[model samples]
Target chain A: MEILNALINITDKGAGFLHSIPALLIAIPLGAAFLAPILFKLWKRLAEIITGLAVTACLVLAIYLVLFLGNTPIVYTFSGGNWEFIQNLLPLGIVFVVDKLAAFMLLVVSILVFFAYLFGLKYLERFTGLGKYYTLYLLMFTGMIGLVMTGDLFNMFVFMEIAAISSYALVAFGTEPEELEAGFKYMVMGEIASIMILLSIAFIYSSTSTLNLAHLSYAFTQMQTQMASTPGFRAGFYFVLILLMFSFSLKAALVPFHSWLPDAHPSAPAPISALLSGVFIKVLGVYAMVRILYNVYGFSWESSPEVFTALIVLGLASIIAGSLLALNQKDYKRLLAYSSISQVGYIILGFGIGNLFALIGALAHILAHALGKGLLFLTSGSVVYRTGERDLGKLGGGLGKYMPWTSLTYNLGALSVAGIPPFLGFFSKMFIILGAIDLARVWDSDPSKPGWTMIAVAIIAGLFAVVTLGYLLKITNQVFWGKSEEKRTLKESPFIMVFAMVSLVVLLLAGGVAFFFWLKPELLGPAADVLLKGTKYGELVLPGLFGAGG
Target chain B: MLILGISLVLILIGLYAIITKRNMIKVAVGFALMEYAVNFLFAIIGFHKVPGMKIIPPILMEVKTTANVLSSYSDPVPQALVLTSIVIGLGVTAFMLSLALRIYNRIGSFDLDEIKRLKG
Candidate 1:
């Protein structure tokens, strides 16, 4: 009876309750992460339950933030809020600025993580060291949630490392020669990304003398305007930005720097693969990059169209290279891995377009691809669980008969990824393609002339969606429906696995249509508005500087 | 400035080793070198230039220390950050070396060229 009251109290969402949430969002996972190993020693079963409960709590809190945290951002500073002497001295202490963008990310991560952990519980029955696996998984979870919430640039790098390091270990958890090698490759690339990011932070610190994102934004803008035509400063600025782009592109698996992904992603145990491909890259790579570029540095589409164009070139390369390369891959997971790169290209393309529709499409693609790729990877795990087969050509047709749920979910997920009707991916792709067309026709930074070159680029990008369909359909034909004769000894996956897969599919379908059509634009508008606000982000986080001084 | 130049040269050498070296252990070494070079830059950048004066520790050494002296204190923020970075570097290097050991246990070689089975 007492416990029930406590549970009810936990659900209470009041003004006081809401203020404490941003810190709890990070603290719960971080606490659980450290507690997991101890729980492992106490009781093997206890760890999984704790993880589930913690993840569910995170999801609930995230949803709370989404519902209540409207336009007014939540600024939770780590140190005392009284400001006292320290506050007047400087922008002291790490602050978590939970605006619409941050809240949206928290929601996306928690949903995907909750389902993936649900899937992992049943899926990881074959593996040993469940305790250690849960520990690292929780750590990575903490890192992901913390990465999104923190308002400090240096802290973001710290969380990024925590996530990156743990993931490298998780990728090699299988300990096979292939898995270890893949992990090594992944580590090398990931570490390089980290180093570059650290170097950038150092650069920012040297120039601005503040590591807080809001403060840095304020100072950086001040510096740029003051020395608008200084050649040396501009050169240095471009250098740092280019370094960041290269580093983050590597993290995002954008074409030229994407070699490690096909190997690293497929080589991980399937659930980790799902987490990595689905949410990890988007958070660590795309989200972080966008935050730094658009918000902190305050680069705008109108002022710096060149940077956006460079993003387009990268997106174009990834789309073309990723799709063309996946055509002949016989391995099932590897094909999906390559598909991830291609799918990610569309997200980058949306960012490249850099308008409201394009940005909305890109953010929506982040959601759609997260669920779609997650479902597909979970389906792959189910197939592996039942039959231990990963090769498309070798996996005979008749698979649907044995594993109806897995096959059905896979198809739903595949269709979504390929941008078919009703599923979330289609809507996201539609927005992106529409954004592309709009870019050529309407979104002209220079009003004197039409964007003719952009139309050709738009057309090519729009056509890549069909190419995506081609490769995905081939997977269906080859793996699940191909005519074959083999003594079939396969059964449907566990209830938990199927439930997780089906839930993702439902969410994918519901979320895609519901977001644009059913849900009020007020919710989605603020999210995209965060990006559109551009350099004004600093003003939102630290109003004293940008708000009053101007 | 001299320290920055030295660290930059060290970073270049580390990059060279990372790019050119085939041995997995040497590659790890290159990573360490690069990490140290970066760490060096972070630590040195915090030093406040006090003309003809000794470097003051960031701690409050005396009561009623002037605000000007407090403001002039070397940037302890980056130093604190570098400490965190070093610890992260340690965790990363330890995990990486363990991976190398495990890989060595399996294939009995540290040559990256030999462990190229995962290429597309």
Candidate 2:
């Protein structure tokens, strides 16, 4: 009897803890972010400090949650206080969930935001509207955290828009002509994408009669089996999926849909650019794509040939197109932005290959890209700060003479991103290539099919690898090694900016060195598991209080 | 069905305006209109034959006690989603307007041709 009572108590406590996970991570940041603008009125510096503290607290909590929470999912639900109908349709109310995958993303996003905020302390001094900047920054941070944490698909869309909208405003913070133009173009495209996403969601809800992601996944599976005879229903479902993929691809800035990125990333302030390239696109675009495709749709490259083909084609196009575009860019930041597109292609290719090693490689590359790209953008920001020049042609040689630390950090970042050995990028690329060869071997076993297609794709990916190295080397040599014709003197950027860049460089090196020791178990392993057992997500997410009735 | 038709027409008009309008401001306005059409479509998709759909969800006890309310209502999830979508639209619209204003201030003209400062 004593043992039975103890078991009952344990279950009760587990239930309570699971319910609180979302409120702890999402609600706190969201509330703090909303109140920050008002708090700024009392004390400007106080507001910034408080926002940073909240994000740091969030990061610590996320790490703890990831460590302690078992494989089971956590759900948090909120019902309207008085309305009876709303309680029945819990989907109408706000809901948040933090599963293993989302919690891991939360950790990455919080770390990036924490550093960006620290960097912003000094970097944002020249820009007007300090309070407004912090407020929006925190708000965007809150949205990103929420996006990663939420369990509801519609809620995900809401958070996505919140982050995207803030990013559009942040990009044009300078109010310069080019900034405004880029901001406008980005806003228009973003709004259209949101519209497409909403339309898809509406269709999905109408079809499934549920808004909860896990519940919808179960419903979709049921429909897939039951409606096998109904061609129209299948067609509608596929159409919604396609719309979703298109919208997310637009946000991800995948090859054909990436017209706005090169302009917007360069136009934004450096910290914002870092946040945009480092975490924003990943969380909003890549993360969502992975979550929806793997969790909700139950896609596997082996099972879903069409989906796999689409992913590979898109990946190849982004790789070749982004590289070719970067090859000719003269502006310093624009070149980096184009390079981001190419690197994102690498991540996509790794994921699409759908092998265990390749998926892990993709997640690892994501971390490396974030650090490398973040460092490079910060360095570019410093260059702009010291000289007020963005055109690479106008920039003279021997930038390292003035700022040796920045030059070294920037060079390390460039090398890492170019996939040089002993860096994080090299290991990730090796894994992807190995996975590709494994996939080719598998295809070859089937004598009816041709392995040439995958072989060609792999060759193209390798060629872009070289192109990436070429441009990065060219930029590094031109900026840091060449002599200036004008004979101008340059000074180092603010201490805070240099610190941020160096810190990111250290992380890039550390991540590369400690990939197996640190990153694999914490991030890559869990992410790979999530994608590998895609259909099992539905099983894990169901069986909760608000779950679909079996 | 009528609402769907209207939304389709509005979307086509918005696309035309975005493609043909020389003024950047007008193009932005076109995009805004297109967004509105989508928002309307979302609202319509969530609409049900029954009336008195509650936007706010009630407590669990009330849900257990109430019978007619649960059966005679539309799904409110899409409406809530649309509210969020509308708010996001507003934020983006505000940002786009500000960008247009800044562009005018910088270039002294609202025409796309005049704001050709950035070259490929």
List of chain B TM-scores, one per candidate: 0.88, 0.78
- Please give, for residues A188-219, the per-residue lDDT of candidate 2 as tens digits: 67777777887788788778778787777777
DockQ of 1: 0.85
Task: State chain A's TM-score for model 1.
Answer: 0.95
Model 1 alpha-carbon drift over 4 Å, by segment: A1-15, A80-90, A443-450, A519-522, B60-71
Error of 1 at A528 (Å): 0.5
True contacts kept of each: 0.78, 0.73
Say which candidate scores most in TM-score: 1
What DockQ was computed for model 2?
Answer: 0.60
Task: Give the lDDT of residue A129 in candidate 1.
Answer: 90
Tens-digit per-residue lDDT, A421-475, candidate 1:
8888887888887777787776476676468767876787678888888888777
Off by over 4 Å in 2: A1-21, A80-93, A485-488, A544-550, B1-3, B49-71
TM-score of model 1 vs. true structure:
0.95
